[model samples]
Target chain A: MRERFITLTSPVVPLERDNVDTDQIIPARFLKATSREGFGDKLFHDWRYDSAGCPRPDFVLNDPTHRGTILAAGKNFGCGSSREHAAWAIRGAGFRAVLSPRFADIFRENALNNGLLPVQLPAPFLERVFTVTRERPEAAVTVDLERQEVRFEGETAPFDIPPYRKRCLLQGFDDIDYLLSIRDKIILFEKQHAL
Target chain B: MNTLFDKIWDAHVVEALPGDTHVLYIDRQYIHEVTSPQAFEGLRRRGVPLFRPGQVTAIPDHNIPTLCQHLPVADPLSRAQLDTLERNCVAHDISLFRIGTPHHGIVHVAGPESGLTLPGMTIVCGDSHTSTHGALGCVAFGIGTSEVEMALATQCILQPKPRPARVRVEGRLPAGTCAKDLILHVISRIGTAGGTGYFVEFAGTAIRALSLEARMTVCNMSIEMGARGGMIAPDDATFDYLRDRPFAPRGAAWERAIERWRALPSDDDARFDAEFTFDAGEIAPMITYGTNPATGIPVTATIPPAADPQALAYMGLHAGEPLVGKRVDHVFVGSCTNGRLEDLRAFASLVKGKRRAPGVTAWIVPGSQEVERRAIAEGVRDTLEAAGFVLRQPGCSACLAMNEDKVPPGKYCVATSNRNFEGRQGPGARTFLAGPLVAAAAAVTGEIRDPRELM
Candidate 1:
């Protein structure tokens, strides 16, 4: 029932590795809760935390300078298990969007349904953004869902979102909500198929 | 110009939206303990009842123990997830097979064997191994928990159509080589992410000649290559495997079923978006040496110089290190990938009349209660027990290490499961993915020797 997506202005965190998988994003041991709460503390649990459960200073996520509301990870991010928890962890960690050249299909769908914007930018533009964010850590970036544009420091790059998905984001509607919009068609199909 | 993937996808489309997306109807859905809890909660939160409860089959596999069926799950967290699934099933009026049920097993194994998955059906599950059902000529794929909730609210998912890629494996597989080796070999060539943005169809003589059980093994690891799913065109072999199964069509319905299934293959002149050909004769007993499944090498081969150094360090192997003669502390022969009855027989046959090498703990767990029962009746249990290998109760034991069957930290485990990702068996545990024959050889020799060595 939770549904809403809008413009966001925040910092960015760039994970500069390809093929980062779901297990590395959120380790299996932390996957016990039925509730999708407090996963922020456990994102990258094994990498971000020490054996004593203290934050590891070496991990980029624990480094205060790399703070951001957006996870600018590498291509094929969320590559392994089809766990929705990875997307939930991103949301719980207070990230509103993810930017990558490519994303694993299941993870992309999960993020979209859970109100996390997945923006696919070309490698050159992504590298430029990475440089800009690293140089000016506090530089506020804007992602306008309505205009389908991502802007930072007077520089702008346009992105694409499925028209139906854009409409869903703008109207705060989930797939079930959209399906309900066309319930009659579904009913007709089921009846015709004689299910 | 339609591939088998397209034929199934076209039939399942309820509506087409802009940007090549479709409102697709799902005929059957399977659920397991690890991913279904939150989806069930979401359903309750939305006050949404299951549209057609019978379309879904829920089972708890990932968190259950293989040794004890009558005892309560020891880990409180695992017990709670299992309990949540059971409660959700009863409240939603969906069919369920709990821990002690004869029908309860790994969803991937149970679906095809129970005839719940058949040709021309669109099947889905929260677990990625749902691709295993695609072996039956279905549009089978994995869905996330959010998608699971969506399907529960309305038996449909919004999906973007994928282009089709055909992988052709020619030449007959040599004796001692299995479907696992062929798939591993293909993954090694294509890398882990090569199949992205496509629904792959495995073709050519080598694939068609595989038995249904072997075909399932090949399809189960389709997710490891990052494909949405992989499918094989249905033939007489597919129908023969399904005939007279417990959930299959019967009598007059059976005759109609075969007639419909016979038409599920791709047209003769159809075109695919992409195609890659491989020689099956080049494949051998395969094993992975790195964290990802793509880092596989043949049994007689050595690690490559350019292999991931981080993975090599974690695995305690150097470049050019031969896979054979490396000591293995444990051997596991169960998971959705290789836990079927044929896999069990392959393992048992290799170890019969031989002693399990000292200090090598071998766990031979079946994928289902029926598999365990059948194995016992077929003397697989007797043979394995004679070799000092225990036939554990049926569940996904030691695969993901959610239960007591974990391989100890820093130890080497020769596994028949799909993924060999770092710590997949347990924290700091190293896994080597192989076919059951390789796993059986490791069990008897306490090392990574080829199965033919014992023969």
Candidate 2:
């Protein structure tokens, strides 16, 4: 997996819902897979499909007008059940980042670990994003991790990204990778503490 | 800086190598059948034997059918997973609690009842609800599948220290309220992501009034708030709960254990990274509206307007809708959250001589064989049967959709399970979370009604 803190390019599909839980994001039936592959198609499977396996035209993502590589959701996105598959599906579906007003704690961590950037913006900022995305269908939003800013078409706003997570994303480091980097220090400390 | 999480992490951190991470030694490891099979396979492939067999305990729960102890597991994959767990445990000489074994139950429930979980120890499990053990004043959290393998092979994991957030519950709980209600209120108020990146410590007067089982209910939902885990200072309640448990100390040993536990409370002036306080009396019987547990309101309250477009669009709920009379097609009372003996007793008392709604299907399941046996002995099973409710055996029966007890797509269920996340009961199944009493009332009314009406 590419670890660099690269810029996201997906069009922003805004979902203004609180408590967007993991099961809704990716259903349990999809969890049976042993490998993490092919989850992209199953992301939001129920919402995207109807009883006959036909695409639901009424769904937001299915709307041809709102096509983007990024998903800008509402407050408390990715709430409920600590399923990492939700993040995996979002990432596999070719989306690199998710911008939201608020993110569920476990879901945020899962997204970050799987290299999916979860951007938390204020409610007002989120509203502004939805307005802009709605008004200008072709609007492109750029999320710069290095600068900690979200720049829309001709407008820019600064957002908060925790310093630790920022460092990890910028360095393309996961929990294990970050820990392994300090292996020598840990070994030394263990040696010194040996009694 | 001196939070329980920091204390535990610092004590266990043997080294900090080149990267911003620490190599930590694990004190205890708990595993269940659902997540351990793949981890064991990984270990086998790597030729890694368990480092400390005694520190690990294995149990089968998630896939075990509730109603039939002898019914061959209908799902081939679930049966294979259980068989794999038993085979692995036997081959590795690890303690395995198979079906019908006295020790077989949800791993979280089994751990505390067995006295294997004690104060001041760090515990790790493969399930997110492992936070349930934090009620014993230990730092416990869930690990991923790969991490489970690492723990089995080396009994250690690399982890970053987490910050602490203290949640204090003061005032006396009103009649009809419980720890389940308190947690639901707290999560709803904070939203689901409120506890992210923090170890929560629950305190104050109202919390003290809760039984250890109730306290476990509160701590079990810590992960729902995005918290790493939750802890409550050990006290008389804690000691009392542990005293008569199967694995607890006896005679002089019991007194010594209590003495040690007494010192496990936090210092009076101890500082926390963050603090939040809520009044217990202000809480009411809470129920979820949208898929997530945090989108909850008092049983009598109307569903809040989906002010946020995303929330409204996703939940498919209109503004100003009275949640009270929302139609429910099913009622589920089971899971580690509310599948205990007390939970069944509460449901049974409410359902006795009361016929369930003709259109509603209610499945009441016990968390373990012990809980089932105790409930049967107390006549709760008979009461449920007479009331037209189906009492299933011990397993995580509809709290999740893993077993055959799933709600049909597009149906609404009032559940006693911890999470009401979208599709938790089944694909496209709408779940409204409530306490057992409230769930019983819903079963009888065929709608989201308050338990107080039944009383």
C-alpha lDDT (0 to 100) for residue B397 of candidate 1: 81
Per-residue accuracy of model 1 over B1-455 as CA lDDT, tens digit each: 56788888888888999988799989999988788888888777777778879899998888888887799888998888888888888988889987778887899998798989999888889988898998888889988898898788788999888889888999999889888899999999987788887888999999999999899998888888888898999999998999999899999999998888787788888888889999999899999999988888998899998987888888999998899999999999999999999999999889999999999988888999889889999999999989998898878888888788888878999999988877778777899999999999999889999898886
For DockQ, the strongest prediction is 1
Q: Chain B alone, TM-score of each model?
A: 0.99, 0.95
The TM-scores of all predictions, comma-separated, are 0.96, 0.86
lDDT of 2 at B394: 75
User: Taking the candidates one at a time, how many backbone clashes does each contain?
Assistant: 0, 19
Candidate 1 residues lying further than 4 Å off, grouped into runs, are A1-3, A131-136, A139-141, A151-157
Q: Which ten residues in a row have the lowest lDDT in candidate 2 chain B?
A: B306-315
**RMSD (Cα, Å) of model 2:** 3.9
Please tell me how candidate 1 rates in CAPRI terms.
Answer: medium
Task: Give lDDT for model 1.
Answer: 0.86
lDDT of each: 0.86, 0.77
True contacts kept of 2: 0.28
